[model samples]
Target: MNWFWFLLFSFTSAFVLTALLRRYALCKSLIDMPNDRSSHSIPTPRGGGVAVVVTFLVALSVLLFKQLIPVDLFLSAIGAGAFVAVIGFMDDHGHIAARWRLLGHFAAAIWALCWIGGLAPISVFGEHVNLGWLGSILAAFFLVWMLNLFNFMDGIDGIASIEVITACLGACVLYALGDADHLVWPALLLASSTAGFLLWNFPQARIFMGDAGSGFLGIILGIVTLHAAWTSFMFFWGWLILLGVFIVDASLTLFRRLIRGEKVYEAHRSHAYQVASRRYRRHWPVTVVVGGINLLWLLPIAVCVTWYGLDGVIGLSLAYLPLVLLAIKYEAGQAEAG
Candidate 1:
C-alpha cells in the first residue's frame, strides 16, 4: 500500500465531496442559525461533516479490503464514529436529550474498548504501572473523554479542524521517525481531509461541523492515539502533548460552568476559544493561534519522542504550562468582566 497514493486520494476526495455536500446541505436547510447563545452570528450550512464521514469510510474501506490495516480496529473505529455521527446529526436537526446522547457516547466507547484491545500499561521513569482489569475501563473512559472534549471545543469556526490537523501532524511525525505503520496512514488521511474542510469553515464561516464532524473526528483521533500507544512509547507521549490544548481548555471550561450557576450539561458559548474569538473580533486569528502553537511548538516536542525515549516527558509537561495559565486567567477575566 503506497501511502502517497492514499494521502492524495484522501485529500482530493474529501475536498471535492465537501464542496458538493456544502451546497447540498444548504439546499436541504441543514444549517445552524445564530442564536443568543451562539458564537457564530450568521446561519451557516451544517452537516458537511458527512464529507468527513464518507471520506474516512471510503479510504478505510479500500485499505481494509486490501488487508492493509487490521480489520477489527478499522471497522470498529468506523462503527463508533458513525454511531456518534448519527446522534450529532439528530442534535443538529433538533433537540436531543443529554442523557440519551451520553448513553450513545458510552456505547461507542465500550465498542472501541472491546475491539481495540485494552490500554497498554504506562512504564514511565523506570516505574511500571499495570492497570490489570482496570485497563479496559480506563480505555473506555478515555475514548468517551476525548469524544466529549472535541465536541465541547467545536464552537468557533475552524478551531476543531485546526486542532485535529495539528494532532495528525504530530502523529505523522512520530510515525515517520519510527516508520510506524499502524497509525501513519490513518493520521495522514485525517489531517488531509480536515485541511480541505477548513477552507470553508474559517472566519465568516460557510458551514459548521455540528456535532457530527466534531464527535467523529474526536473518536478517530482518540482511537488513533490508542493505536499509536500500543505501537511505541514515543507515540504515546506525542499523543498526550498533541491533545493538551483541547484537554486543558475543555476541562477548565467545564469546571467553571460547574462553579457558576449554569447547568454543566447544557449548551453554552463560554469556551476559552469562544471568549477569545469575541474579544479578538476575528475567528481566523484564534484558529491561527491554535494552529501555530500546535504546529510550531507542540510538533517540535512530539519529535522529541524519538530520542530520550520517555525522557522527553518534561517537554510535554512544559508545553501545557502556558495553556493552563491561559485557561485560568481567561476564566477569571471572564468572571470579572461579565
Candidate 2:
C-alpha cells in the first residue's frame, strides 16, 4: 500500500472514531462540566482523543508490518504509548490520584527510554556532548514534563489538536529536508490523525480531547523527539524548535505559578493561550494563531538548524526568544485577573 493510503486511512479512521466516541461520551454522560478554571462554558463530551490514539497506533502497526518502521521504534511507540493512554483513559473515566498518575507517567517514560536506547548526545554550541546517565534522567523528566504540559495546554477547544497537527506536520517537513525520510511517517501519520479530530474539536467544540489523547500525544512526541535525536542532534533541536510554543507557554506558566507559592499540580487557566482565548471571547482565533506561528515562524528556524548547520543551541534560543516574550505578554503563569 502506498504511504498516502495509510495517511488517508488514519484520517478517516480518526474522523469516524471521533464521531462515534462523541456519541458514546454523550450516552455515558462522560462530559466535562464548566468550573472556575474551565475554558469552555457549555458542558461537552470529552475523551474524543481516544480516536486519535487508536488511529495512530493502528497505523503504526501497519507501518511496522510493512517494514516501514523499525521494530525498536515500533515497540517503543506501542508499549509506552499504550501504557500512558490506558492510564489517561482510566483517569478520564474517573479519578486517579496525582501521585499515582505521576508514578505511572514516569514508568512509561522509562519504558520508552529503555526501548529507544536512552537519550542521545545533544549538540550544544556546535559540539556533541553526552550527558551519560544524567542525560537519561533528564530525558525521563523531559518526557514526563512533555506529557503533562500537553495535558495542561489542552484547555481550550482546538488548541491542542491544532498544536499537534502543526507540530507534527512541521516535524515531517523537517525530516524530509534533512533526508531522514524514514522518520517522516510517524509524524505525518500523527498529524493526519489529529487533523481528523480537529474537525470536531475546533471552536465551539462538540467534543474535547480529554486526558487520554493529550497524554498520548505528549509521550509519543517525546519518544519521537528522542528517537530523532539519535539520527542527528540537529533533528533533536529541530523538533524542539518545532514544539517551542507549547513548551514555552506551559513551562513558563508552571514556573510562575510555582514562584507564587501556588500548588503547581492544581489546575488553573493561567496559560497564555488560555488567557488569550478568554480575552478574544473565542477559541478558533487563538488556535489559528498558534498554527500560524508554528508554520510561519518556527518551521523556518527548524529547517535552518536541521539543514543549514545552524548551531542547535543557538537555533533553539532564537526560536524560543520571541515565544517567551509572547508568553510574558499574555501574562502566562500569572494569577487570573479578577
Candidate 3:
C-alpha cells in the first residue's frame, strides 16, 4: 500500500501547516481570549483546526477528482464535513448560540444518514438487529452526540488533538491490514493535521482548536467511524475500541452532570481532563497522560484488529476501564477538596 511514505507525508504536512497557521491566527486576532471557563492564561490563536480541515478536504478532493473513491459516499461525506466546518467557523468567530450549533449538527447528520442510506443494527455475538427507521434516527442522534462530545473534550491543550491522532492511527492500521480502504485516507489526513496542531498546543499552549476545529473534527471522525462500523460486525468493534477515550470521558461526565441536575448544555470546566489539568496546575501533564494512554494502552487494543481478531461489537465496550477509574478518582478528589 506504500503506507510508509503516505504516513510520513501526512504527519509532516499537517504539523508544519498547523504550526504556521496557529502563529498567523494569533497575529490576525483569530484567537480565543481568556475567560472564566478557560484554563489557558494567555490569549491563544483559535481555529488552528483550519489546517486540519484544509488537509482533509483538499486531499479528499484530489482523491475524488481522480475517481479514487465511490462517488456517492465520497461526495456526501465531504459535503457534510464542509457544511459542519462552516457552521463551526461561524460559531468560533461570532459565538453563535447552542441552538444554532444543534441545528447545524442535525442537518449534517441527516445528510450523512441519507448518504449512508441508514445504519444496520449490529450485534457481535447475537443476531444482528435492524431497527429500521428508528436506527437511522438513533444513528443521527449518536453522530451529533459524538460531535458535541469531541468539541466539549477539546477544553484543554492536546486532549482533542491527541484523541483525534489516536483514532486516525487506529483507522490507518486497520486500513493497512486491509480492513477498510476508504476509511483510511480521511482518518490519516485528519490525524496528520492534528500532528501539526499538537506541536504548538502541547508542552506550552500557543493555540486552541476552538469550536470550528473541534466540532468539525468530531463530526468528521464520527462519520468515518460510523462508516467503518457499518462495514461489518468486526469493523464496528474496531471503531468503538478506537474511540474509547472520548466516549468514556464524555459519557461519564454527561451522566454525572445529568444526575447532579447541572445545566448540561452550558459550558463548564468540569471534564475529567479539565479537572486533572487544573488540579495538577499544568496542561502538558494531562496531555501526556492522555497520549500515553493512547500510545501505550489504546494502541494495543487498536492492534487487535491485526492481531487477535477481537472485533466483536461488544468487546470494544470494555474500553471504558481507564475512564471509569479516572472519573471516579477525579470526582472524589473534587469532593475531598470541597
Tens-digit lDDT string for candidate 1 (141-191): 788888888888888888999899888887777787787755677787888
lDDT (10s digit) by residue, model 2, range 1-338: 78787788899999999999999999999999999999889999999999999999999998899998998899999998999999999999999999999999999999898889888997888677899999999999999999999999999889888888899888988888888999998999999999999999986799999999999999999999999999998888898998999999999999999899999888899999998988999988998999999999999999998989889888899999999999999999999869
Error of 3 at 163 (Å): 0.7
Candidate 3's clash total is: 1
Question: lDDT rank, highest first?
Answer: 2, 1, 3
Per-candidate TM-score against the hidden true structure: 0.93, 0.98, 0.89
Which candidate model has the greater TM-score, 2 or 3? 2
Give candidate 2's TM-score.
0.98
lDDT (Cα, tens digit) per residue for candidate 3, span 1-338: 46566556666776777778777776778877787777778877887777777777777776677666556567667877888888888877787788888998999988987887666676656567888899888889987988899887888878888888877887677666755676666677678767876787787767787777787888777677667666655565666677777777788888877877877787777777888888899888887788777767766676674447664643565556766788777762132242
Model 1: weakest 10-residue lDDT segment is 329-338
lDDT of each: 0.79, 0.92, 0.74
Each prediction's total of clashing residue pairs, residues at least 3 apart in sequence or on different chains, is 0, 0, 1
- The true-versus-predicted C-alpha distance at residue 260 of model 3, in Å, is 2.6
Query: Candidate 1 — which residues are off by over 4 angstroms?
Result: 310-313, 332-338
- Give me the displacement of residue 30 in model 2, in angstroms: 0.5
Model 1 per-residue lDDT at 254: 77
